[model samples]
Target: MSELEEAPPESGSLAELARKYGLRPAIARPRPGVYLRQLWERRHFILTYATSRNVSRYSGSALGQLWQVVTPLLNAAIYYVMFGLILGGSRHIDNYPAFLLTGMFVFTYTQRVVTSGAKSISGNLSLIRALHFPRASLPLAYTLQELQQLGVSMAVLVLIVMLTGELPTWSWLMVPVVLLLQTSFNVGAGLVMARLGASVRDLNQLLPFIMRTWLYASGVFFAIHDKVVVSAGLPEWVATVMYLNPGAAFIEWMRDLLIGSHDLPRTVWVACVFWAVFALIFGFWYFWRAEDRYGRG
Candidate 1:
C-alpha cells in the first residue's frame, strides 16, 4: 500500500480527538477559516484611522488630551450640583460626588459603546461601499475608542480618590477584573447594535432614548440602597431591581473594588458574568451571519 493508505486510522482519529478535547491544532494543518484576505486588505485602513483619531485629538490644542480629563470633571460638577446638591442624591450617598463620578464614568462607557456602535457601519458608508473588510471592525474600533477614554477617566478617578482619602487597598487590584467583565459586556452589546443599526437604521434614532432610560434605571442619579420605603411595605424590591441592572452592577462592582465598599453582592457578579458571556457569543454570531452584506452600498 502507498504511505497514505498505509497510515494507521488511529493517528487521524487521535488528532481529531485532541481537537475535540480542546487542544490547539497546529497552524500548518488547515482549519475552517474566516475571510483572511478581506481582513488583511482592510486592516491597514482601520489602523490608520484609529491612529489618526488618537493623534488628532492631541495634535493642535495646548491642553491636548487634557480635554478628556476636563470634560468629565465638568460633567461631574454639573451633575453633582444638579443631582447631589439641588435634586438631592447627597441624601443617599455619603460622598455623592465620588459616587456620581464613578457611576457616570462607567455608564458613559456603555453608552459610548451602544451609541457609536449603532452608527459604525452606517456612518462609514463611503468606506463600507469601497472596502471589503469585516463590518465588525467598525464597532470594534468604537469599543477601543471608549476604552481609551475609560483609561483616562479611571486615572483621574484614582487621583480624586487619593485626594479624598479613599486610599487603595489590595482589594483595588480587582479593578482590572471588573473592567474586563465590563468590556466583554460592552463589546457583545455593541456588536449586536452595530448589525441592528446597519440593517434597521431607525435604531440609530431610538438609541439615545434607550440610553437615557438606561441611565435613569442604572442608579447614576440615586443610590442603590433600600432607603425608600414602599407604601405597602413591599420590602426592598427597588434595590433589587437596581442591583439587577447591568450598568448598576458594573458601577457598583467597580465601587466595591475601587472605593473599598462591600455593598455589592455575589449575585451581581454572577449576573454580570452571565450577561458578558451571553452577549459575546450571541452578538458575534449574529454579526458574522451578516458579513456578506456589510460592504454592499
Candidate 2:
C-alpha cells in the first residue's frame, strides 16, 4: 500500500467520526456531577438573573415593589374574611390572623417558585436554544427571585405578627433554618417542575388548580388537626399526612416560630428535613436525566 493512501478513507457514521475526533454534541447531556458543577459555577449569573427578574416583575405596576408585601397581605386578608370569618376557621385558634398570615406567606413562596419554575424552561425556549448553560439555572434563578421577594414579605410578617400581639423569643432564631429547609425543597421541586413544564403542554393550564388544591390541603387558611381530625373527625393519620406535605410542613414550622402559641410536635421538623432532602435529591436527578431533550422537539 502507498504511504500517501488515506487510511481506508476513515469509515463509519458521523457519530464514529465525532468519537474519533474527540467531539460531542453541543447540547449533549452531561454527567450528574458535571451538571451540578456547572450549576455551581454559574451561581453568580443565576443570582443576577434572579435579581433582575424580581426587579422587573412588578416594575410595570404603579405601586412598584411595594406590591411584594402588599400582594400577600391582601391575599391573606381575603382568606381571613372568607375562611377565618365566613368559614369559621378562627374558631379554635388564638390570634388567628397571625396564624393565617404566616401560612399564607410561607405557602406563597413555594407556590411562586413552582409556578414560575414550571414555566422556566418552556417559557425560555429562545434563551435555552440560544445559550448552552445549565438548564437548571433558570429554575434556580426563579427560586432565588421568590426567595428575595420573601425577604421583604418576612419583614412585613414580623411586623404583623407583633401587631397581632405575639412576642419575639429565642425560638425566632430558627426562622432561617426553616427557610433554608423550605428553600431546599423548593429548589428540588422547582427543578422537577421546570423539566415537566418544558414537556407537558397542559401543565401551565393545570398548575393553578393544582396550586389551589395544595393551598387548601396545606392548612394555609386553617389549622390542619383542628379542621381535619377534630372537626371532620377524620383519621389522625389524615392530618399527619397533611403535615408531612412539604408545603404544610414549612408553613406549620413558620407558624410555630412566629406565633408563640402555635406549638407543634417534633415530627414536623422531621418532615421538613425529610422533604428537603427527598425533594432536592429526586428533583435534581429527574431534571438532569432529561437534560439533552430540553429545547428540541
Candidate 3:
C-alpha cells in the first residue's frame, strides 16, 4: 500500500499536526483563569453589545424605552388591583402602592436578567458560532441591559415612595449596597441559566410560569411576614426559608431601604451576601465547565 493508504486515521494525524503548529480545537475550552481573563479583555465589547440591545429593544414601539419604566408600573397597577385591593394584601403594609411597586421593581430586575440570559445564547447562535469570545459574555451583557432598564424603574420607585409619604432616611444609603449584592447574584444566576438554556430548548417556554410563581411566592404584592407567618400560620423556619430566597431577600432589603415602615431581619442581609458569593462562584464554575459545548449543533 502507498504511504498515504498505510497511514493512521487523518483525525489523529490532524490533531498531532495542530499541536505541532500551536493550534487548538476550534471550540476548545480554555482553563478557568484563561476564560476569566478573556472575558475581562472583552468587557468593552460586552458593554457595547448590551447597550445596543437596550437601544433596539423598544425601538419599534412608539413609546420606545419608556416601556422599561411603564411595563413594571403597569404590572404594579394590575397586581395592586388583583392582590392589594381585591385580595386585601395591602392591609398590614404601610404605603401599599409603594411597597408593591418596590417589590415589582426589584424582583423584576432579576427576572428580566434571568429570562434574557437564558435566551442570550440560543437567540444569538450566529454570534456564538461566528466568534470565539468567552461565552459568558452573552449572559453578562444581558444582565447589564436589564440593570439599565432597572435604573429607570428605580427612579419611578423613589418618586412613588415619596408620593406615598415615605421620607428618605439614612437607610436609603443602603440602596446601592442592596443593588450591588443583587446584581452579583444575578450575574451568577444568569450565567447558570445561560448554560442550561443553551442545552435545553424548552426552558424558555417554562420560564414565564416559573417567574409568575416566583412573583406571587416572593411577597411582591403582599407582606411576606404577614402572609407567610400571620396568615399561613407556617412555622418560623418556613418563613425564614422564604425570606432566604434570593428574590425575596433582595426585594425585602430594598423595601426596608425605600419604605420607612418596612423592617427586615438581619438574616436577610446575610442571605443576600451568601447567595451572591455562592451563586457567583458556583455559576461561573458550572457555566465554564461546559464552555466548549455552548455553540455546538
Candidate 4:
C-alpha cells in the first residue's frame, strides 16, 4: 500500500487522541462555582454600567431623574381616579392613596427590572460581542439600574406616605428586609427574561401586557384581601393562593410596614422567602446553561 494508505487510521481513534491533547476550548462552559466567581470578579463593571445607563436614561428628559418619581406618581393619580373614585375599588380600604401608591412604587420596581432585563442581552449585542465579561452582567446591570431608580422613587414614596398621614413606626425597620428579598426576586426575574428575550425576540413585546395583568392581579389599586378573599367569598385555599403571589406578598409586606395594615397573612412572608430563593437558584442555572450561545447570532 502507498505510504498514505499505510498510515494509521486518522479518522476515529486519531481524532479522539487529537482532541484529548488539544488545548481546551476557550469558551467551554464553566463549572457553576467558577462561573459565579467570574461574575463576582466583574461586579465593578456591572455597577459602572448600571450607573451610567441609569444616568443616561434621563439625560435628555427635561426633569432628568425627577421623572422616575413623577412617572409612577402619575400612574398612581390615574389609578386613584379610576379605581378609587370612578370604580369604587377603594371603598373598604383606609388611606387608599397611601395603599395605592405603596403598591405602585414597589410593583413598578419589579416591572421595570423585568421589562428592561428582557432586553438586556438582545439590546446589548454590540457590548456582548465586543466584551469577554460574563453574560450575566448584562441582566445584573439592568436590574441594578432599576434598583437605583426604585431607591429614588422610594424616597418620594415615603414623603407621599407621610403626606397621606402615615407616620414611621418600628415596623418600618422591616422595609430593608423586604427590599432585600424583593431585590433577589427581581434579579432572578431579570435573568430569566434575559435568556428568554435573547431566544424569543417577541418576548419584549409581550411583557407589557403580561405585567399589566400581573399588576391588576397583584392588587395594586385595591385591597386584594378585602375584595378577593373577604368580600368575594373566595375559598380559603383560593385566597391563600392569591396571597402567595410574590408581587402581592411584597406589597403587603410594605403596606404592613409603612401603612400599619395589620391584616397581612403570615403565609405571605413564607411565600416571599420561597419565591426569592427559588427564583434566584432556578434563574441562575437557567441563564448559565446557554452562556455559550448568547452572542452567536
The clash count of every prediction, one per candidate, is 0, 0, 0, 0
For candidate 2, the per-residue lDDT at 163 reads 96
lDDT of each: 0.76, 0.92, 0.90, 0.89
Candidate 2 residue lDDT tens string, 112-225: 999999999999999999989999999999999999999989998999899999999999999999999999999999999999999899999999999999998899888889
- Tens-place lDDT per residue, model 3, 164-248, is 9999899899898999999999999999999999999999999999998898778788877778788989888888888998999
Candidate 1 residue-wise lDDT, 179-258, digit = tens: 89889989899989988888886898787788889988787767656344332244576677768789889988877776
Which parts of model 2 have CA positions greater than 4 angstroms off?
A: 1-12
Ranking by TM-score: 3, 2, 4, 1
TM-score of each: 0.80, 0.94, 0.95, 0.93
Which portions of model 4 miss their true places by more than 4 Å?
1-18
- Residue 202 of model 2 has an lDDT of 100
Q: Root-mean-square deviation of each candidate, in angstroms?
A: 10.2, 3.3, 1.7, 2.7
Model 4 alpha-carbon miss at residue 271, Å: 0.6
Model 3 segments beyond 4 Å from truth? 1-21
Task: Select the stronger candidate by lDDT from 3 and 4.
Answer: 3
Sort all candidates by lDDT, best to worst: 2, 3, 4, 1
Residue pairs with backbone atoms closer than 3 Å in model 2 (clashes): none
